[model samples]
Target: MNKVKLLNISIDNISQAEFFEKCKSGVVFTPNVDHLMKLQSDPEFVNTYKDATYKLCDSKILFFISRFLGTPIKEKISGSDLFPAFYQYHKDNEDIKIFLLGARVGVALKAQEKINAQVGRTMIVGAHSPSFGFEKNEEECAKIIELINQSGATVLAVGVGAPKQENFISKYKDQFTNIKIFLAIGATIDFEAGNIKRAPKWISEIGMEWLYRLLAEPKRLWKRYLVHGPSFFWLILKQKLNFYVDPFNSDYSEPYKGVTREEMG
Candidate 1:
């Protein structure tokens, strides 16, 4: 696979076609610096989820921080940004079909309408909104898979938040071999459907996108930015200091006790 470097992070540079081909029966993580630091610090978590694969991507905040720290890191096109390319690809090739899974209320349909209008035509075959909680609805899940299969969708874009979306993809990839891509695009549909606003280019460039989001939905995001943001930074710093220590030398039995999968889900 082709690759690029920005700061110290190496990013894979696979085209949409190549990416779809590579993602068979495995989970792909769009990791930022914070995610990398967390994984490095907690090898047990990585080991526990060894079935999953990871790809480093440049979050805007991480990009700015890397520049400030004088580290080299290159930005890879994110899952959210894949829509335009995928839409064009679908137009050119009539064989491809896509499924949009998960979004708040009417956002998925709105996104479908918008994309269809923007592209003149679209490959979107089906869409759904799963419930918020972690409790599994096996019947509903099976119905979703059946619907995708019936619709002949070759790609699935899951809008569920991580790592639930990641978990779902990892769990269900085998059942849907006809599906070429399973992307866990966090909040992309909401932004596309006008339910949420993405930060302006300047704000994103300056790493204040989080601030913009916080300002927009303070009740929902305040804790994530104000609390988790600082903690993430501190964890990154600690990981940097521990670079000399052999990461894998530590006992694998010790798990990351701070947060449960439920909390993250």
Candidate 2:
């Protein structure tokens, strides 16, 4: 498990199996609304992307979780639901060391305190709150790498939001050889730290998590859930119609089969 290269990301080439193999410790499988929107725009491109994503999710060595509003199925759980499971696993197995990175100013510290109080001597090695932005100074990047390496943590939970967090892990993966797992858990740190309230179980179970999120933070998420939500459904419909006539002989409609989109299409 030392320096295993599982992910292959090139400009013109990508493989899903490689990504899954790389998650021997653990990996994050995040699907933001924006990514789904991008997929809806181009089924071929998205199918390729999702193929790689789902392969990674299927890894047994890696803990799979998605940070999304509504999934295709009713019984699927959100990333928030899996956080406690991850915590409990670490609590039971003292060999796994965790490092918390990113979140609001004091959110990481608060989360560390909460987990420690609850778990009673959990195996959290260290925690830090990184500044929000893409361009990181040399000093900042060096500091983060040094902290992770010195902390001796195997799992690192990053909460700096999409693309940014993913890019950060890609940039620094080689620096922390001891780090086996890297999770880009968008806003889970805030929710776990009690900085934000999660939606009720009933609301989440019914796939109305988007509505609850909109009510909670309308200004920030209105464009994402409200505007983009219907747009996704519309794109789904269009793809369905295209599949029915076999215009291009594409298989985009099969992934969402037995669902409303399949019936309507």
Candidate 3:
């Protein structure tokens, strides 16, 4: 699929329906402004996104910017939007097993319980909550991988946060031969588990979800939205003025592939 370059990140121009239909067993990411900015100085993150099977735009802010830049993305397919929809789509398709990884202690288990009560519980094959630095521990990573294999899950949703979740999936996705779908959903699990409240529909519709989030957890998110958020505009301005260098060649953004399916293994 052809992707447009906003900040050197290839944002796929796909709609909600097309993205869901494209979903399968592979590393899928929903890149927002924070994620795209991180890709600038972080080569590991850049490499992770480069190999991603699906790069869905999660930020409404990015959507507006894309349109302003004359490279409009069809719609936003964020982790929160995609996660519930994925389960709802497979509500009757019990063959689609799912594994919930990441989140604070007991969060995944509680999320599984809530989802099970709402949808069918049988599809949630396994859930785990790794320690803060569990990824750094070889034995811990081994156990986590083993648990996923034992669960026989086809879909894996990693809600451990941005670059960490992305790096984890990129590092170990090939190890899960039976796995199909991987989502680097930031805090969707916490939202599902009722630990955090989402913004009202109207707020989200108008593209102020970030503001709502900043209000919800001011201490934690202040730096993310308040500090790092403002810098994104300068990058966009640079791109618009034909000054920003797209490492993958600026020509790749043309012939926009508005919608396409993921190549599932």
| Colliding residue pairs in candidate 2 | none
lDDT of each: 0.63, 0.58, 0.83
1-265: candidate 2 lDDT, tens digit per residue: 1111111111111133343334456445455444455444444533344222221221111111111211211124245655565777557667677888878788889898888777778667788998766336768888889988999888888877655666677666778968877776777888889999988878765567778888999999898777876765554455444332221225443433323323445
For each candidate, what TM-score against the reference? 0.76, 0.69, 0.91
Q: Tell me the TM-score of model 3.
A: 0.91
Per-residue lDDT, model 1, residue 138, is: 79
Per-residue accuracy of model 1 over 97-203 as CA lDDT, tens digit each? 77888887778988888877776766777777777763288788887787788878887888776556766777777788578666667788887788887888787
Candidate 3: regions farther than 4 A off: 246-265
* Candidate 1 colliding pairs: 6-72, 6-73, 6-74, 7-71, 7-72, 7-73, 8-72
lDDT of 3 by residue, 120-207 (tens): 5687878999999988898999899999999998888899887899999999988886888888888999988988888987887778
Error of model 2, residue 61, in angstroms: 26
- Predicted model with the maximum lDDT: 3
